[model samples]
Target: MKRAWKVSELARAEIRHGCSSNPRSLTHFLFTLKKSANHGSVRDLNVDADTHSSSSSSFDSSALFSNISRLFTAKSPTTLSETLTEDLAQEVAQLRDALARNLHDSDEVVRVLEENCGPLLRRFAGGSAIVHLLKQLDSRPSLALEGINELISVRWLLGSSFSFYQPKDFNYACKVLNWRRKQEDCEFPMTEEEYAKGIALAGKVEKVGLAIELFSEAANKQLRTTSTYNALMTAYMFNGYAHKCESLFWALKRDPNCSPTIATYNILILVFGRLLLLDHMKLTFKEIENLNLSPNLSTYNALITGYIRAWMWDDMERTFQLMKEGPAKPSTSTYLLMLRGFAHSGNLEKMEQMYELVKDYMTQKHNPLIRTMICAYCKSSGKERIKKIEELMRHIPEEDYRPWLNVLLIRVYAEEDWIEAMEKSIDEAFERKTTVQAIGVMRSITTTYFRSKAVDRLATFIKRAESAGWRICRSLYHCKMILYASEKRLEEMESVLNEMENSNLSQSKRTLWILYKSYLSCGQRNRAAQVIGLMCKHGYEIPMTVLPS
Candidate 1:
C-alpha cells in the first residue's frame, strides 16, 4: 500500500534544460531525479531480474512512449537514451550517488567539485558565491583573486579591499585594482577622508610604517590635514622614532597651510621628555611663550615629568611652584610626580609634606601618593618612621595596595635582618603575583645578603622563588653571579653564566659588564676575554679598565 508519486512532464523538462545549461543546477536536477526514482512506477528500473521481467511485461507502454516523445521534443528530435549518451548517463548516476552521500557535507562537495569539475564550477557559479565558498574553505590567496577581480569589476572597491585579512592579500587586491584603473584611464586617488581612515586603521593595528607611508602619500598629493599630521607625529613618537618625529614636526611647522595646535607642542614636549632631552624641552616651552601661546596644565606636567626623570629636584620644585602661580591648577599627576621624586631621593619629610598638601586635591580613588609615602619610609633608616609608615598602611584599603610596595617592605626588613618579617613580606608578594617587582626585590635582597655574608639565606630564598614559579631574569642572574664571585664560588658563577647564555633573553650591557667582572674575579682570564668579546660584538663599548693590559 505504498503511495505512488511522479514528476510532471513540465517539471522534467525544466530540470533537463537547467542541467544542460548550467552545471551548478546539476545538484537541483539530481534532487528531482532522486524523487522520480523513488516512485513505484520507476521501481522496475531498479528491481531484481524476476521482478524486472514480470514488471516490464505489465509496464504502462503508453506512458513510457509519451515520456520518450516529450524528451525528444525537448531535446531537438533526439531519442532519450541517445541524447543522454551512455557516458553522460553513467556520469549522472555517479553524481547522484555522490550528491546523496555528500548532502550535508559542504566541504566534501567542494572538494569533489574542485578536484573533478573546477573549471565548470567556476564558469557556472557566481563570483560572490565562489568567494564565499573559498572563504569557508580558507583557500589560498590566488584562488580568491577571481572573486577580488569580480568585485573590482563591479566597482565594489571597499568590499574588495576589506575582504582580505592578510596584509599581502590586501596589498595584492589594491595593486590589481590600481592596475585596472590605470588600464581604464581612471585614477584611483584616495580622498582626504579615505587617507585619514587608512592612517587611523594602520595606527590602530600598530603598523607604524604603513601609517607613515599613508601620511607621506597624503602629503605628496596635497591632502595632508592637521589631524593627519598630528596622527603621524603621534605614531612616530610612540614608535621611538625621535629623529623622524622631530623632522616631521619641523616639516609641519614650515607648512603654512597646516598650523600646529597646542596638542602639537604638547606632543613635542612629551617626545623630549621620553628621550630625556631636558634642554630641548625647555627650548620648546620658551618658544611657546615667545609665540604668546598660553601654557596649560599638561604643559607644566610635561616639564615637571621631564625634570623628575632627569632627577633635577630643584628644577621640578621650581616648575611646580610656577604652575601653582599660573592660571592652571595642579593636577593629581603633578602631585604624584613630586611624591615619586621625593621618594626616589629618600626625602621622607618632603614626601609627607607633599602628601598632606595634595591629599585634598586627589580626585581619583587610586592615589599613587600613598604608595610613594610607603616607598619613602621603606628607603629611610629610622625605626620610628617605619613604625609610623606601618600605622599609615593600616589606614589604606587592602585592595588599593600595590605589590611593588611590598618589595619596599622586604627591603626594609632585609636591612634590619628581620628574617621573619622579610619571609612574610615575600609570601605576600608571591600571593600578589608581582613578577617584575618580585625580581627587583630578589636582586635587592641578594645584594644585601652578599654584603652580610648570609649565603645560606640567599640560596634558600632563590630556591623559594623558583618554587613560586618566578623565572629568574637576566638581572637576577647577574646578581647571582656577583654573589657567587664574591664568595669565590667560581664553578657556581660559571653555571649561572651558562644558564644566562642558554636563555632566550638578551643580556643588557650592564649585565655583560657584571659577568665580565665576575669572570675576572674568578681568575678565569680566557673566559673573561670571551665576555669582553661578546660585549664588543653587541656594541657595548668596553672600558679600558675592564680590558686586560
Candidate 2:
C-alpha cells in the first residue's frame, strides 16, 4: 500500500514548482503557504513498481517544503497581522517613490497614480497611501503646492470619495513645516510663478473668493508684482467684479514695483465700456496717452463701444475719426460696432458705406455684419433690399446661418403680407428644430395675426406651435387676451387667463394693468377690482395714481 500524501505536502510541492519557475515570486509562494495552513487534506498516491519510487517521491516533497519554509522565513512575516502591515508599508513606500519622481511633472503624476499605484494602494494600504503621499510632497515646499493641486484634480477626475487633503491644508502645512525660506533672506515667501498659478487656477474654477484670498496672502507676504496684480485683476474681470477690478487698478498704480501695462488699461476700458461709464472710459484713455502709451486697436474699440452704448453718436464719430488717423487700424470688430451703431440709428447710407469698405476683409462667410444689415433692412421695410441680402446670405453655409436670421426673415415676410412664405419659413424652422427661432417666429406670427384681426389664422398657428412641442410663453397668452378684449369677447379673455394660471405662468404687471383697463372699458367694475387684487397677490403693489377716484 502507498501512503497518502498530506495536503501540506502537495501545497509545498506546488509552491516549490511555482518558485522554481520564477525565483522572485515571493508573494505567490506566501499565498500558497497560507492556503495549505488553512485547509489541510490528504490524497492517495499510486506507487510505482520500482522499489525506490516511493522513497524518491517522499524525499522530493520534504525538500520542497523545506525550501518554501526557508524562503518565507527570509522575507515574509510569521503572522497574518504582521504580513498585512508589511505589505501595506511596502505599498505606501512604492506610492511615495512614484509620486516623488512625478513631483514636478503633474500630468505624469496623475497618469501613474491612476494607472499603477491607485489599485495597489487601495488593495494594500486602504487609500491612506494618498494621505501619506501628500505628506511626503508637503515635506518639500517647492513641489508641495503644485503636487497637491495635481492630486486634487486627479481625484476629482477619478470620482474618488476619499477626502485626502486640500490646497488649503497644503498652505497650512507649508507654514507649520516652516517650509518657506527665512524672511530675512527671501523677500517673498511664495515665488511669483507660484502665486500666479494658484490665483489663475482659482479663477479658472470661478472661485473668485478663493482667488482673492490667495491674492491677499501674496500681498501680505509683499509679493505684489505686476503679473500678480494683473492675475488678480483678471480673476475679478472673469467674475464680473468690476468695482474690485477698479480698486486693484488704482492700487497697482500706487505700487512702486508695479506699473500698469497696456493690457491693464485695455481691461479697465472694457469694464467701463460695459458699464456705459463713458467718462471713466475717456479718462482711462487719456491716462494711456498721458503715460505716453500708444492706444491699440482694442483701446479705440472700447471707446467706440462705450460711446455707442451711451448713445453718444457725436462722441463715437469723433473717436472713429481719431482712430482713422492713429497707427492702430480698426479691426473687423470696429467695423461691426460702427455698422451696429448705424443700424440702430437708422443711418442706411453710412451702413452701406461701412459695408463697402470692409466687404473684402469680412473673411467669415456668415458674419454678424450680414445679420445686422438684414435686421436693418427688415426694420426699414426694404423689400428690394431683401433680395440683395438673400443673395449675400447664399454664400454662407446652411449650418453657419444663425437661427435668429430665420426669425428675422419670417418677420419680414409677415410684414410684406406674404402669408404662404411666412408659414413655409416657420415649417422649415420647426423641421430643423431651431427651438429659439421657432418660438420667436411663433410669437411674431401670433402678434401679426392679432393686429390684422385674423383670429382664425392665429388659432391655427398656435395649434401648429403646440404640436411641434413649443411651450407657448406667457407673452403669447397676454397677446391673446388683448386681442379678445379688442374684439369684446369677454368669455374668450377669461378662458385665456384661466389657461395662463393653470400653466403656472404669472401675469406681469403690464398684463394685469391691461386687464384692469379692459374691465373698466367694459363697465365691469367688480372685475376691474378683482384684477387689482390679483396684481397685489402676484406681488405687484397698486399705485394710488392708478386706483379709481
Candidate 3:
C-alpha cells in the first residue's frame, strides 16, 4: 500500500513536469487521476517487492522491525495517490482479460464490418446508381422502387433484385401497400423510399455480381416471387454463367416452394443451345414436359435456332417435324432461318421448297417476311429463280424496295454468277424503309454479291452501313470487310477499316486482320509487328499462321 502511494505520487510529479513540454501528457494525467478515486477494493498487504516473499526467517525479521517501528512509529496521512494506484491496477487487469476474449472470430465481428457495406450500402446507394446505369445501357425506363414491393408478397420472392429493386415505371400503389405491410412493427419490409432508391441503384450499376448479392440478401429477409427469380436468372445468364443458369432451373424444381415455369426452362435450354450442348438441350425439352410443364414456342425456338447455327440438320429437321405436328406452331422466324441457311449452303431446290411452304402458311398480311425469305432464295438460285422472284415481287407489300434492289441478283442469276446478289442487295436497300427486313434483305443481296462478282455494289452498301446506325457492326459487317479486302481495293479497304475505328463496335480480331493485311500489302513489316502487339493488347489471339513469318 505504501509503495502504490509512492508510484502514484511519482507519476503525478512526472506528468506535471512534462505538461510544459507536451499538453497531451497533462490530458493523460487527468485520465489516470479520475481512475484513482475508487480504492474501496484495494488490498492492504499488497506491496511491490515483497509480493512473492515466502521465507519464514525473513517474514519474522520483517515483523520484528514492524514492532520496533511501531514503538516509535511516525503516523503518515493516507493520500489520494494510494486510491489512484489501486484503480489503475484494476483497470490494467480488466483490459488484459478483454484482449484475450476478443481474439476469437465471431458473428458480432463479421456483422459489424458488414453493416457498412451490406444492407445499408444497398439501401443508401444501390438503387439510383443501378437504375441510372441501366437507362444508359438499354435506354429502358427505370422501375419505381415503391412499385416493387408487390413482388415480395411471397416468401421465395425475397432473394430477387426485382422485388426490392425494380424498373422505374412499376405501380407505386402496390409498392406503397406492400411497403406499408413489410415492417416488423410498421408492417413493411423497408420504407418505400429505401426500396425505390436501392432498386434504382441496382439497375444502374454494371457490377452484376454486387447487384445479385444485394438482391439475394433482400430476398432472403422477406417474401419473393418467381418473377424476382427470373430477373436475377436473366442477369446471371447475361453475364455468361451458363452453369449457374442451368442450376437455377433445377433449383426451382427442387425447392418445394418454387416451381420452374416455361420461361425458366426456356432460359436453361437457351444456355445449352448457346453452348452447343445438343444432348443437354434436347433433354431440357423432355425435362420440362416430365415436370408437367408445357413448353412454349420460345423453348422450341431456342432449340431450332441452336440446331440451325450448329448445322445439326438431322436434329433441325426432327425438331421442325415435331413442331409442325404438335401444338407448337413455327413462326416466320422458323421459315426464315431455314431459308437463310439453305440459301447460304447453295441448296437452291431446298430453298425453293422452304419458300413455297412459307407461302402456304403465311397469309397476305404476314407474307412480306416470307417474301423477304423468297427474295433471298431467288438471289441465291440466279437465273432459275428469276420467275419465282417476279411472282414473289408481286406479293411484296407496298413501299417495299426488296425486288428493285434484287434486280442485280436477277442479272447475276441470269448469267449464273453470284456477284449479282451484292448489287441487288445494295440497290434494293435504297428503296426500303429502315426495318429488320431491310437488314436481312440487304444481307441476302450482299452475300450473293460475294458469291458473284458485284464489288462495286458491295462497297457502296458497306460504306452506307458504316455511315449509318452508330456505325455498322455485327457479323455481316465483318463479312463485308473480308469481301472488300479479298477484292483487293486497298484504298477503299483502308477507308472502311478507318471507318470501323470510329464506330462503337469493336472486334479486335477484325481490327487485327485488317491491320495485318494493310501492313502486309504496304510491305510495312515493322508496322505489322507493332500492330501484332496492339492486337494482343486488345485481347485478339493472333492466328498461328500469322504469328510471325
Q: Which candidate leads the pack in TM-score?
A: 2
Q: Indicate whether candidate 1 or candidate 3 has the larger TM-score.
A: 1
Q: Candidate 2, residue 186: CA error in Å?
A: 16
Q: Across residues 242-278, which tens digit of lDDT does each residue of candidate 2 receive? A: 8999999999788765567565676688668667788
Query: Model 1 misses residue 496 by how many Å?
Result: 26
- Runs in model 1 with CA error above 4 Å? 1-205, 213-223, 357-372, 387-407, 414-420, 426-549
On lDDT, the stronger of 1 and 3 is 1
Query: What lDDT score is found at residue 401 in candidate 2?
Result: 47
List runs of model 2 lying over 4 Å from the truth.
1-204, 213-223, 356-370, 395-405, 417-420, 432-549
RMSD of 1: 28.4
By summed lDDT, the worst window of 10 consecutive residues in model 3 runs over 26-35
RMSD of model 2, in Å? 27.9
Ranking by lDDT: 2, 1, 3
Query: Candidate 3 on 1-549: residue-level lDDT in tens?
Result: 446445544543443232222311111000000011132110111011121121010112111111111111111122222323443444334432332243233233223323322332233221222222221222211323332323345443444533443434332222322332333352113321233223323323323543455445545754233333444554455456677766765665665554555656666665676567888888888887797765545566667656754667677678777778887676544565565445444577777777775554444433333444454554463555656665765775655444333444434443444444434544354445332244444455456656665667656666666554312445455555566666665566556655656665565676667667766776778877888888888887777887786
lDDT of 1: 0.53
- TM-scores of the candidates are 0.43, 0.47, 0.37
